[model samples]
Target: MRIGFVGGGKVATAFGRYLHAHGLAVSNYYDRHEDKLSHACRLTGAHPCQSAAEVAKMSDMVLITTRDDQIEGVCRDLADHGVIRKDHLVGHMSGAHPSLILHDAARQGAAIFSLHPLQAFAEEEKALADLPGTYFSIEGTDPRLASVEEIMAKTGNRFFRLLPEHKRLYHLSACIFSNYLVTLMACGLEALSHSGIHPEDGFPAMMPLIQGTIDNIARLGPPKSLTGPIARGDVTTIEAHLTAMADPSLASLRQFYAFMGLKTLDLAIEDVLQDPLKANALKKVLEMG
Candidate 1:
C-alpha cells in the first residue's frame, strides 16, 4: 500500500521511517512548515508534498499525524480538494480524538479511523525503534478497517479494536497507565523524602522495586503478582502507614494512599487469597481514617 502522512512532525517522521524500514511504500509528507517537511523527508526518505491534498492524492492510505487539533483541518483540506478515493483509508494518530472527528474525510468516501500507537513520541529514533514493541488501538466509523488491521499485522504488532464511543475510555486508560504512573512515582518519591532520603537519590533507589513489580505484573498478571501488606491482610502495617500519613504536610499523600489501598485491597481479595472478610476489615480501616 502507498502510505502518506499529512503532517511532518516527530510522529509522522518516526512512523514514516518505521514503515519504510518494514518495506512498506511510504509516500509524500506535507506540512505548512518547509523546514519540518524537509526534516521529515530527510529522516523518512519520503518526498515532500506541497499540500495535504497532494499527499492524499498519491497514497492509498493517508495518515494524518498532525497535532490532535489539526487533524480535522487536514482531513477537510483533502476532502475539499476531492483527493481521497473511494475505499481509501484515512486515519489519525491521536488517542484523544476518535475516528469520528474525521467526518470530512469520510464524506469524501474514505474509511476514517484512529490508529493510536500506545507510546509516547519523545525521540524520533527511539520512537521508530519502539514501534514493533508497541500495542495499537484502532477505532473507526467504517467496516473497511481490514486494511488497517492488515497493516498492523504486517508490522507484527498486537492491536485491538475499540468502539468509537469507547475511544475516550481507552485514551483515559492510557493516560493513567503512562502519565499518571509518573505522577504516582513522584508521590512515592515525596513520601520517601520525609524519611530524610533526598528525592533524587530516593527515586533511583526505588527503581529496582518498581521495575521488579512491573516484571512481576508482566509475568504473573496483576492479581497473582501483587504482594504487600494489603495482600497479606496485615492491618497493623497499614495502620502504621495511616499514622505516618496523618501529618498536615502529607495530607494529599494520605488520601492518595487510601484511594490506592482500597483498589489494591480489592485485588487482594480477588486473588488466590480470596479473603473478603479480611478485605472488609481493611476497607473499614481505610474509610474510617
Candidate 2:
C-alpha cells in the first residue's frame, strides 16, 4: 500500500522509518516545517511533498501526525483542497481525543481512525526499534481498519479497540499509571531530600523496591499486594510517624499519610484478619484527623 504522512515530525519519522524498515511501502511525507520535512525524508528515504494536498492526493493511506488540537484543522484543509480520495484511509496518533475528531475526513469519504501507541517517543531511532512492544488503543468502525491491524501486528504490537466515549477515561488511566507515577516519585524524592538524603543517591535505592512492589501487584493483586506499616496493622508505628512529624509544615504530609493509611487499613480489613487491639488503635488515630 502507498502510505503518506502529514506533519512529519518525530512521530512521523519514527513510524515511517519503522514501517519502511519492516518492509512496508511508505510513499511520501509532508510537513509544514521544512526542517522536519528534511529530517523525515532523510530518515525514511521517502519523498517530501510541498503541500498537504500533494501528500493526500498521492497516497492510499494518510497519517496525520500533527498535535491533537490541530487534527481537525488539517482534516478540514484536506477536505477544502479536495485532496482526500473517497476510499483513502486516514488516521491520527492522538491518545486524548478519539477518531471522531477526524469526522471531517470521514465526511470527505475517507475511512478515519485513531491509533495511539502507549509509549513516549523522545528519539526516532530508539522509538522505532522499541515501538513494537507498545500497545495501541485504536478507535473507529472502518472496514479498512483490518489492513491497519495487519500492519500493526507486523510490528509485534498489541492492538485493542476503544470506543470513542471511553477514550478520555482510558487515556486518563494511562496518565495515572505513567505520568502521575512520575509525579509520585518526584514527591518521594522531595520527601527524602527534605530529610537530608541526596535525591540522586536515594532514588536508585528505591528502584528495586518499587520494581518488587509492581511485581507483587501483578502477581497477587492489590490489598493482598500491599505491605509496610498499615498492611501490618502497626498502629504504634502509625502513631509514632504522626507524632514525630507533628510540625505545621509536615501537617499536610501527615494528613496525606493518615488518609492513605486508613485506605490501606480498609484493604487489610477486607483481605487479612488483623489483631483487634491494633485495628482499634489505627482506627482511633485515623479518626483523629
Candidate 3:
C-alpha cells in the first residue's frame, strides 16, 4: 500500500518508520511543524508534502496521527479540499475517538477506520521497537477490515474489532490498566516519601514486589491473585493504616485507601477467602475513618 501520514508526531514517525523498515511503501507525509515534518520524513525515507491534500494525492492510505481534538478538523480539511478519493483508506490513531470522527472523509467516499495501538509511546524509537506484539483495537467498515489487518500483520501485531459505541468503555479500561497504574505507583511513592524514603530509593525497592504482583495476576487472575492485609481480613492492620493516613492534609489519600480497602474486601469475599462476618468486620474498620 502507498501510505501517507497527516501529522508528524511520535506516533506518525513511529508508524512510518515501522512500515518503511518492513519494506512497505511510505510515500509522503505532511505536518504543520516544518521541523517535525522534516524529521519524520527523514526517519521514514518518505517525501515531505506541503499540505494534507498533497499527502492524500500521493497515497492510497492516509493515517491521521494528529491529536484527538484535531482529527475531525483534518478530515474535514481533506474532504473540503477534494483530497479524499473513493478508493482511499483513511484512519486516525486515537483510542478515545471512534472511526466516526472520520465521517467527513467517509462522506467524501473514503473508507474510514480507527486504528489504536494498545501501548504507550513515550518516544518514537521505543514505539518502533514496541509496535510488534502490540494489540490494536480497530473499528471500521467490513470491506476495509482486511486492509487494516494486513497493516497490523506487517508489524507482527494482532488486533480485535470493536463497535463505535464500545470505544469509550474500551479506552477507559486501557486508562485504568496503563494510566491509572502509574498514578497508583505515584501514590505509593508519595506515601513512602513521608517516611523519608526518596522516590529513587522507593522505586527500586518497590519494583520486585510490583513485578511479583503482576506475575501473580497473570498466573491466577484478579481475586485469586489478591494478597494484602485487606485480602487477609486483617482488621487491625487496616486500622493502623487508616490511622497513619488520618492527618488533615492526607484526607484525600485516607479516603482513597478506605475506598480501595472496601473494594479489596469484596475481592476477598468473591475469592471465598472471607466469610460474611469477617468481610463485614473489614468493611466496618475501613469505613471507620
Candidate 4:
C-alpha cells in the first residue's frame, strides 16, 4: 500500500524512511514547515506535497504524525476538505490517544487507527536504527486492525493490540517508564549535590549503576532484580538515609525518597523473601518521613 504522511516531523520521517526501506511505497510527504517536508522527502525518497489534503488524495493510507494535541484537529481538517476516500486508512502515532480521536476521518468513511512505537524518537537516524527492535501497540476497528499488523510484520516488528479503554493505562505506564525514569535520575543528581559532588562527576559515576540495574531488570524483571535497602528490609540503613535528608532545603527530596520507598516496600514484601518483622519495621521507617 502507498503510505503518505500529513505531518513530516520526527515520527513521520522516521516511519517513512523505515517503511520505504522495507519495500513499501512511501510518498506524498506534507507539513506546514517546508524544511520538515523537504527533510522527510529527502530521507524517504518521497515526493513532497503542497498540502495535507493533497497527501490524503495521493496515498492509500495517511498517517498524521503531528503532536498529540494537533492530531484530532488535523483529522478534522482532512475531513473538512472531503478528500479521504471510503476505503482509505487514516492513523496517528500518538500513544495516549485512542483511535476514536480520528472520528472526523471515520465520519467521512475512512478507517482510522492509532499506531504507537514503544521507543523514544530523538533523532531520525537513531529512530531508524531503533525501529527494527521496537514493538508497536495498535488499536482501532477490529477489521481494519489487520492492516496495522501487516505493516508491523512486514517491517519485522512485533506488536500487541489494545482496547481503547486500556490505552490510557498503557500510555501512563510508558510515561512513567520513560519520563519519570529521567526524573528519578535527576533526583539522584540532586542527592549528590548535597554532598558537594559536581553533577558532571556524579552523572558519570551513576552511569554504570544505572546500566547495571537496566541489565538486571532485563534479565530478572524489576521485582526479582531489586537489591536496595528496601529489598533487604534494612531498616537501619534506610533510617540513616532519611535522617541525612532532614534539612529543610532537602524536604522535597526526602519526601520523594519516602514516597518511592513505600511503593518499593510493597514490591519487596510481595516478591522478595524477607523476615516479616524486618519488613514491617522498614515500612514504619519509610512511613515516618
Candidate 5:
C-alpha cells in the first residue's frame, strides 16, 4: 500500500524509509522542518509535500508521526481541510495515547490504527535500518488491523495486538523494560564508581555480563532467569552492598538498593528455595529502609 508520512521527524522518517526499502511507496512526506522534510525525501526517495493535505491527497495510508501533543492539532487540521476520506488508513506511533486519540481521523472516515515500536530511536539512520527487527504494539479493528499486521510482518518485525483500554499498561511494561533498564545500569555504574571504576571503563566491563543476563532472560524466562545476590538469597552479600553504599555520597544508591531488595524478596518468595526464617529476615532487612 502507498503510505504518506505527515511528519519528517525521526519515527516518521525512519519508518517511511523502511517501508520504501521493502518496495512500498512512501508516496509523500510532510514536515514543518524543511531540513527534516528534505532529509526524509532524500533518504526515502519520496516527494516532499507542502502540507498534510497534500500528503493525504496522494496516498492510501497516512502516518501521523508528530509529537504526542501535536497529534490532535494535526488531525484537526486534516479534518478542517477535509483531507481525510473513508479509503485512508490513519496511524500514529505514540504509545501513551490509544488509537482513540485519532478520533478526528475516524470521524473523517479513515480507519484508525496505532503502532508503537518497543525500542529507542537515538538516530534516524540506525532506527530505519534496525526497525525491521523490532517488536511493535498494534491495535485496531478487524481487517484493517490484519492488513497492517501483515505489512509489519513483511518488515521482519513482530506485531502483537493490545486492547485500546490496556494500551497504557502495555506501554508502561515496555518503559520498565527499556527505560528503567537504563536506570538500573546507571545505578550499577555508580556502585562501581564508588570502588574507583570510571563510568567509561565500567560500561565496557559490564556490557558482556549485562547482555548475557538479557540473553538468559530470553532463554530461561523470568524468576528462573534471575541471578546474583537476591536470586541466591545471599543476605550477607546484599547487606554488604547496603552497608558499603550507606555513606552520604551514595545516598541515592542506598535507597534504590533497599527498594530493589524489597522487590527481590518478593521474587525470592515466589521463585527460590526459601526457609521461612530466612525469607522473613530478608524481608525485615529490606523493609528497614
Candidate 6:
C-alpha cells in the first residue's frame, strides 16, 4: 500500500525510511517544518506534499507521526480539508494515545488505527537501524488490522493488539521501562558522584555491571535474577545503606533506596534459596528507615 507521513519528525522519518527500504511505497510527506518534511521525503524517496491534504490525497494510508499533543489537531485539519475518506487508512504513532484520537478521520469514513512502536527513537538513524526487531502495539478496527499486520511484517517487526482502555496503562509501563530507566541511571551516576567519581568516568565503568544485570534479567526474569544486599538477605548491609543515604544531600535517595529495598525484600522472600527470616529482617530495616 502507498503510505504518506503527516509529520516529518524522527519517528516519521524512521518509519518511512524502514518502509521504503523494505519495498513499501512511501508516496508523500508533509510537515509544518519545511526542512524536516524535505529531509523525510528525500530519505523515503517520497514526493514532498505542501499540506496534509495533499498527503492524504496521494496515499492509500497516512501515518500521523506528529507529537502526541498535535495528533488530534492534525487529524482535525485533515478532516477539515475533506481529504480523508472510506478508501483511506490513517494511523498515529503516539504510545500514549489510542485510535480514538483519530475520531475525526474515522468520522470522515477512514479506518483509523494507533500503531505505536515499543522502542525508543532517540535519533532517526539509530531508530531506523533498531526498528526491525521492535514490537508494535496496535489498536483499531478489525477491517484495518490486516494492513497494520502487513506493515509490521514488511518491517520485520512483531505486534500485539491492545484494547483501547488498556492503552494508557501500556504506555505507563513503557514509560517506566524506558524513560524511568534513564532517570534511575542518572540517579546512580549522581550517587557515584558523591564518591568522587565523575559522571563520564562512572557511567562507562557501570555499563558492564548494568549490561550483566540486564542479561540476567533476560535470562532468568525478575525475582530469579535479583542479586544484591536485599536479595542476599543482608540486613546489616541494607541498614548501612539507609544510614549513608540519610544525609540531607541524600535524603531523597534514602527514600528511593528504602522503597526499592522493600521490593527487593519481597523478591528475596519468594526466592527458594533465600532465608525467609533474613528477608523479613531486611524488610523491617527498610520499613524502619
* Top of the candidates by lDDT: 4
**C-alpha RMSD (angstroms) for model 6:** 1.5
TM-score of each: 0.93, 0.90, 0.96, 0.96, 0.95, 0.95
Tell me the whole-model lDDT of each prediction, alpha carbons only. Answer: 0.88, 0.85, 0.88, 0.89, 0.85, 0.87
- The residue-by-residue lDDT of candidate 2 on 13-107, one tens digit each, is 99888888888888899888999999888878888899888998889988999887888899899988888788899999888988888888888
Per-residue lDDT for 149 in model 4? Answer: 87
Model 3 TM-score, 2 decimals? 0.96
Q: Across residues 235-266, which tens digit of lDDT does each residue of candidate 4 receive?
A: 88999999999899999999999999999988
Tens digits of per-residue lDDT for model 3, 1-289: 8999999999989988888988899999999999999999998899999999999999999999998899999999999999899999999899999899899999988899888989898987888889886899988764866888888777777898998889989999999999999888988888899879999998999999999999998999989988878777788898999899878988988888888788777888889465677788888888876
The 10-residue segment with the lowest total lDDT in model 4: 139-148
lDDT of 2 at 283: 86
Residue pairs in collision within model 3: none
Model 2 lDDT, residue 49, Cα? 95
Off by over 4 Å in 5: none
Q: Count the backbone clashes (under 3 Å) in each candidate.
A: 0, 0, 0, 0, 0, 0
Which candidate, 1 or 2, has the higher lDDT?
Answer: 1
Candidate 6 residue 274 C-alpha distance from true site, Å: 4.6
Higher-scoring candidate on lDDT, 3 or 5: 3
Give the clash total for candidate 1. 0
Candidate 6 local lDDT, residue 39: 94
Tens digit of per-residue lDDT, candidate 5, span 158-227: 8789888899999899899889988999899888888999999989988999889889879976677677
Superposed Cα deviation of residue 1, candidate 2 (Å): 1.7
Candidates, ranked, TM-score: 3, 4, 6, 5, 1, 2
Give lDDT: candidate 1, residue 117: 91
